[model samples]
Every structure is written in C-alpha cells, then in structure tokens.
Target chain A: MLCSDSDLPAPPQEALDALCLRGARLLSGPVWAAAEVALAAPVVEAVALQGGRIEVFLRTPAAPDEALCGVLEDSADLEAALNVLWSGIDAILPEDTARTADATRRGP
Target chain B: MGDLDRLNSKLAKLKGKDDGQIRASATDSIVSALLTEIEETILPREMILTNESGNRFVLVVAGRRLLALSGHGAEEEGSEGREDAAARIIAVFRGPFRTFLDNAREISIDAARPPNRIDPTMIGCSVETLTAALVGPGQASVADPVAAACDLAVAGLRLVGGDVVGRSGDAAHLARLEQFAGVGGAGLGQLAGDDTDAPCCVFLSDAGREDAILARIAFRGAAALILAPPEARAELIALCREPIPAAG
Candidate 1:
C-alpha cells in the first residue's frame, strides 16, 4: 500500500525497529487471514524482506487514536495480540524458533 | 417465543427467588450473552474447541470502553480454493488495512515471506478465538468464569515470557505495550486501544528466537486464548483447589 501512496513519505524502517527494540510490536501478515491470525501490526506503511527479517515500516501512533484491533496506547497490545493469534497457528518463525518455544512449554 | 423470549421467561421464573439465586441467574444470563454475541460474530457455528482432557470452551474479546467487532472470518488449510482464500482475506482485511495490503502486494513481499507462512491450526485462533479469549472467564466479575479465563490468559502470557514490567523505562521514543495496564490498572489489554473493530491483522515478523517466542506470546494474547477448563473457583477451592494452571 505504501507503494501507491508514494506521494506521502514512507515512515522510516528505523522507527518501527526502534519500537521493536523498546519492545513495540507489529504483526507482519496481510489483513485477510483471520483463520491464520497473528497479532495486529500497527500502521504498516511498508514491508521488505532483506535476508531473513521482514522489515515492516510502521507508522508510530503519534496520539491517542483508535485502531481496528487493540487500543492505541497499550504498548503490550502487540504482545497480547501474538498470544491469542499463536494459540493454534504454528511456526511462523523459523523452525528453530518453534523448537525453542516448544522447549519452553512445560510438559506434563 | 424465541431465544431472548426464552431467556426472559427463564428470568421471570426467578423473579421471586432469593437474592443469591437472583444474582447468580443474572450473572449467568448477562455473561453468557456477552460471550455468545462475540462467538456468533466470529464462528460460523457453535463449535467449541477442546483439548486432550475433553474440556470444552471458546475465547472472545472484551473491549476497553468498547472495541470494534469484526464479523469476518479468517482462512485455514482445508480451503475450498484460491478464490475462497481471497474472499476470506478480503473479509478480514477490510477498511484502511485493505489499502495497506493492496499496496504491499505490488512489491511481492508476501511471496518472499517464509517465516510468516503459518499453519493456521497452530496460531491465529480464528475470530472464534481472539475476542473470545478477551471475553475470557473473568469478564463477568471478580469470581466469575471470565476472571478465571483472564487468569489463564495471564498464565499463558507468562508461559511465553510476557511478564509485567514496570511502566517507566529509559527516555526512549516509545514504550512496549507492556508498559500500559488495562481496567483497574492491572496491565491487561494495555494496547487494546479504544478502537473501532477487532479481529485485526495477521502476524509475520522475522526476529530472533527470543523475539519469535515473544511474538508467539503476543499472538496468544491477540488470540486471547488458553486451554484451561472453566470451573467454579469456589467449589474447586473447597475441593482441595488444584490450582488453575499458572494463573495470576
């Protein structure tokens, strides 16, 4: 979508990365897959796949605003979203990541 | 005459009941309605998800003040076809987000995304899962099924390494969603902004193993789901109280 809106400046990839470092969250999928639901990625202006990382350019919520999914102000909103989405869907990350998650699961 | 009529009739029968009886009935009626509305909005049927123990339950979202309710459904593996997938995808990514995806396709980033390719059965609980999880076992009250669900969700987060960190951090431009707390300032749904609709975005990020774990944890929260059996806390506690697994 950012490509079409070329007139408008794309938000820097660094901004979203900063949020990620600060633990800001973003969802990476196209909005259409509910059955394969992941958490909501905030204002996704652009997306790129450099090597392994899918560099998503997101518009940081500048003010108290309404999102289609979670509350805007909630920082942990992304984390919460991921929790719900991944309850069933699996291994969106590399297989190794999934193994790590499985490792953490306290088995009976 | 119908469902509401039947519900009303049931309520009428309880009119002369004792205070305790009336409160319990009222709580059940109101809470069930909240859960049912969300369920119908998401799932095509009253299908309930169960675990190895045969414990039957579902998840739903409870908003802050009020969050938007999405009626669309997400897609899964056994699809009818590409057309079916396209239709479902369109349904999920409505409004401004649709624009976001539309532009995204031009560069074909979706094709390049491998780490994001998901087995829906593993993540995205469908709409049936998310809001339902938020509706939780604790939405009704402090001692209701909604509270218990919330506790389970909290445990689920903890299981995935999502801990309650302090609100204040360094002088950074943004703080993680963990910093904010939800109702009663308890750190629930902190990022659940007073938004319009729910059942939002699908997750696809390529972070480290730890970030992946965190993402999965966030996906759990977004899905708002857990596999805890819904039981009465009071009676269960009196019966030696095998704790609700890892709840807060």
Candidate 2:
C-alpha cells in the first residue's frame, strides 16, 4: 500500500503498522523480536535505571573550550540512544580542516 | 605524473593485491580509503540528532555510554516503544559493511562488566567478527582500527621494499604500531611469491605524504606499515563522552 509523495492520504493504524513491519522483516527474526521486546514502553523506561540521559554538550559544532549543554528535556529515551549512536561519527572528522578551508577560499 | 601513468603504476604495482583465489587481498589506496572511513566515521562531531528528512530528534545519552547520533530515522513516524525504530536501529548497527556505508552506526558492547539494553549476542558477534577480521588477541576498541591500518601499511611496505622495515624507519613508530597488534615480521612471501601467478609490488602510503612518513616506513623503494601520528588517534577519540578504557 505505497502512496505517492504528492497524494499521501492519512494511512490507517494497521496499514502503517504493516508498512513498518515489512520494512524490517528481512534483517533477522531474532533481532526484530529482541528489539520488539525491549522497545515496549516499560522496557524503554528501564533504560533510565541503567543511565537514562547522557550529557552531550555541543563541543563539536561550536566552541570546545566552552561547551554548551544540550536541551533534551522532553524527548523519549529510545530517541536519545539513537541520537548518541550517530554522535560517535564525530570521532573521525578529518584533520585537514585548515587546508580545505584554504582551498575553499577560491571557490565560486 | 599523468593520470594514465599513475594508473599504470597502480596496475603494475597491483598483481594479486585485489583479485585471486587467496584468503585476503587489499591495496594501498583501498587501505587509504579505509583510513579515511575510520577518520570520518568513528567519532562524534555534534550532539544534535538530525534525521534523513532534515528534521531533528532529541535525546541525551549517559554512560552505560552516551554519545550523539546524526541522521537516524524512524520507519513510521512515532515514539520509541510502539515504533520499531529500535529494531531498525539494531539492524543498522549489526548490518553489513560497517553498518551500511551510507548509514554507518556504532555497535555497543561491554568489554568491561557494565550492561546496556543491546542484546548480548549482537555485541558478541561483532566482537568476534572484528577480532577475526582485523584485531588479533585483544578487545575491540581504538586499537583495533589503528592496528588494521598499520597492518595494511606494513604488508604494503614489504611488497615494494622487499623488507618489513625497508631501509630507513623510526624505531619508535614501528614499535608503537607493533604494540597495537601482532603485526610484526610480515614478510613479502606471505603476500606474493615470484613463482606464483600473483607477482607484483604493493605499497602502504601514509595519509598526507606522497611517501611513507611515520616510522619512516619503506623509504628505500616503497612504503610499509608504520604508526599514524599519535595526535590522529587522540583527536579521533576526543569527542566520545566517556573514556574507552584502553584496549588491551
């Protein structure tokens, strides 16, 4: 039940559920099952006991010397974990920023 | 040199480095690309979680380990539990080729004894795979990637210089990479033999230099493995919120 971007009608709960389930059934059964077990609301809340919210200040995008605390006061736990998982990518930024910046000075 | 000349040099240099009925095969540029990948993918740069549709998702992570994620998405628009985002996220973490090249994500594990929500099997499998693929007899951490690069550089050096250390080298640099893994005494015969169908020269090039720099690896005629500058590793891990206890 795929819909074109321009004419996307409000999909029903069951159809949306089916669409989501179909998106991930191919990876592995156990992985889906395990995640389904943990992704339950109660299970997701249990993460708070294990270290709910990690403090990720803004050092990479702005001044590292004076890092700013992030604002995630109202977001859910699973979303937080997913956010941090992507954050590790910052570890591998190229060391040649100055050189590239110099090269970019001549760009149109 | 011209691109064609460089291409021929690359082709001449690459004999059995790419294709064969062998256990493994890799080239210096491919290795360079790996380093570039490690550099671009391993660390955190921002605390914001931007999704694929250019929207933002919000959350904070603490140790049991806390880091930031960028460009993560939920399959159907919704919250955590009801949504299968966790399943999708796990699949991405445990997915193929460093979690799919376009959407690479990190996997969580407990090298030391604290636990997190991720399935134990996922960590175990990734550890075993990373160990068998690159790490030798040690836990996977910063050292695993550093060792992989040095191993490639070392093997490349042996091919072009006819010796592991070549003619000139920095003893400190060689010792440092050697400490990361058991990548010592990798001989030329291990990669290619004159009597075999795979006969060619392969070189291990350092990141910014036209020739090898650290350990002065392969200065005689070709480049071999050597430690990248300590600063590169330092800068890479600088962004992680919690210190990864030194990899053994």
Candidate 3:
C-alpha cells in the first residue's frame, strides 16, 4: 500500500514531501512503498522496496538509523521489520511529546 | 550589634531542630530577614538573586525611592514574584547558619567593597554562599558559561540534526565519547595520526570537500561527523544514507 503525506502527524509539509520523494526515488524498483509517521519532535519516514530493503529517516532531527535495512525475503521478515520500526517510533514519540509540552509551558 | 550577631539572633529559632529542618528553617528566616533589610536600606529597586545552580529570582520593589533607583516612578510591571525568588534562594542554601551570616555580611558590606575587586576564592564555598556574596541580596545574577553551553546544546540543537548516528550503544556498540583534538582543515593524514577512537568529530570546512573528507573519516572509524557549513547538511545526510559495505 502507498503511504500518503496525510498519514503523518503535524510535520512541515516541505520536509514530508521531500522525504516521500526521496523514498519513492530510492524504492522505485519492483514493489515500492513509503510510510510517514508524524511525531511531536521528529517525523519518521520509512521506505521499502521490493527486495525488502527499508530506509528510515527522522525529519527534523534528520538522523538515519540504517541498521534495520536488509532484504525482506518473506512476509515474516516484513512483519518483524514493521513491528521493530513502529515500536521504536512509538517509544521515542512519548518522550518527545512530553518535552515539547514542557517547553511550551515554560515559554520562550 | 554586628551583622553576624543580628543574623544569629534572627536564626536562633531554628536551633534544637534536626539538621535538615534547621537548614530549611534557617533559609526561610534568612531570606525573609534579608529581604526586609534590603527593603529598608536599598528602598524600591529591582534586584535579582541567583544561586550556584544558575537559578535566578527577581524582586521588583515598588515605591517612589525604588523607582528613583532606576530613574522611574511607575512600578516595573511583570517583575518576578517575591515568593518564587525566596523559595529559589532557600533551595540552594547549604548550612543555614553559615549561609545566613555570609549573606548578611555581603549585604552589609556591598557599598564598601570596591567595584573592581575580584571575587574571593570560592574553593570550599557552597553555591548559595558564593552566589549570595557575588550577587548580594538585591543584585542581578550573571550568566554561567557551563550552564549556558548545556542549555544551548540541549535546546538549540533541535534546529541542527539530533544524533545522526544512534548514540553510543545503539547496535553499533560505538562508545559514548567526545573529544576536541587537532585543528580544523587537517588532512586525513593528521586525523589518522590523532585519536581515531573518538566516536564523533566536528570538522570546520567549506562544503566542497565533504564527500572525500567524510569517506576518509568513516574509514578512520569516526561513527559520526558534524560539518560546520550549513550547506554541507544535505551531503552529509546523503553520505549517511549510503549502505554500509559487507564485512569480508
């Protein structure tokens, strides 16, 4: 399934578009897929190609963790990859949200 | 009576209490007594109190004389509340008796000390005592360099990319380390000669040589690179996106 920009939360539109464009270009071969997960601090972009290779990038922070990139040879591997990325993103979002909330309350 | 005697008498009510309770009571007593003295002597002036931890408490005294200190009559709107300032002062106090005495002495001697006099050695001084002497009871606090750097790195770094490579132990098992060694613009040869074991290095350079420079550092075991030029960010991200070669 193709991922839409609306799938992500409140990230900068420009960054989300750029991330999706890059993902599409990189995964243009056989089965291309892209997902953007909106997060308070940084939006997460996950791109997967037919060979099961996936690249994840964090939008605002711009950090990339390529350790998870590998060929997804089967459905089980795809499920495991999705679980790992979603779990990692879920874990980081709460802390980021709390920090953003705290900063807002403290004022500039 | 001497200032110490006055402070001691004021704090006498805190005697016969446990150490923690004594300290707590002493700080409250000292802050109240000091603020009262400041109101009487200094009149209506704006002042800030800072503790060793770099916390600041501001007091805006309202009155004609206080306004005259700042060459104005209208009360300064939005001055920091007195209760918050007092609480901050109490939080950093070490020993109630010593801190109160020292704070009192500083207030009493503020006009006598030379404006150009360097601060006395703070080698065994608590943060509250040091700050009390330096800032006095009704003075503004100065910025602390270390704290400022920490705030900048923590808060300001949001615009810059947060951790590009996962920190120390995120799968790469890279050690958490930071070091400033070698001058900028050094060739790969100099970097190789210096400590390659440092997990991160920031290079000062124009964007043109980034690709070659980045590849060289990656080969030299630098897990992360922070380029100085803003234009280098995209190139750096692209470099990071490249797949790691298979281990032979």
Which candidate, 2 or 3, has the higher TM-score?
2
Chain A TM-score, prediction 3: 0.28
Give the per-residue lDDT digits (tens) of candidate 3, residues A1-108. Answer: 124435446546684565455443322321111101000111223222212122342222212322122222211233345445544643444465646645665788
Candidate 3 has an interface RMSD (Å) of 22.6
For each candidate, the DockQ is 0.01, 0.01, 0.01
Give each model's whole-structure lDDT: 0.27, 0.28, 0.29
Comparing 1 with 2 on TM-score, the higher-scoring candidate is 2
Runs of candidate 1 exceeding 4 Å displacement: A5-108, B1-191, B195-206, B209-248
CA deviation > 4 Å runs, candidate 2: A1-108, B1-54, B58-72, B76-88, B92-141, B155-208, B216-248
Q: What does the TM-score come to for chain B in model 3? A: 0.20
Model 2 C-alpha lDDT per residue in residues A1-108, reported as the tens digit of each score: 233234545657785554334222311233223322222211111011002122222223221122222212111232334345335423433446434434555564
Clashes of 1: 67
lDDT of 3 by residue, B1-248 (tens): 86535644554543323332212223434554544444454333344433333433333333211111111111232133523333323333323323434443222211222223322321222223433443333222112211222121211111112123322212221111111112111232232222422211222221122221111123223223221223332333222222222234
lDDT of 2 by residue, B10-120 (tens): 333332232321211123222223223223332222223222334443221222212212233433222335333333333333232222222312111111222334332
lDDT of 1 by residue, A24-61 (tens): 33332222121012212223222221111223323322
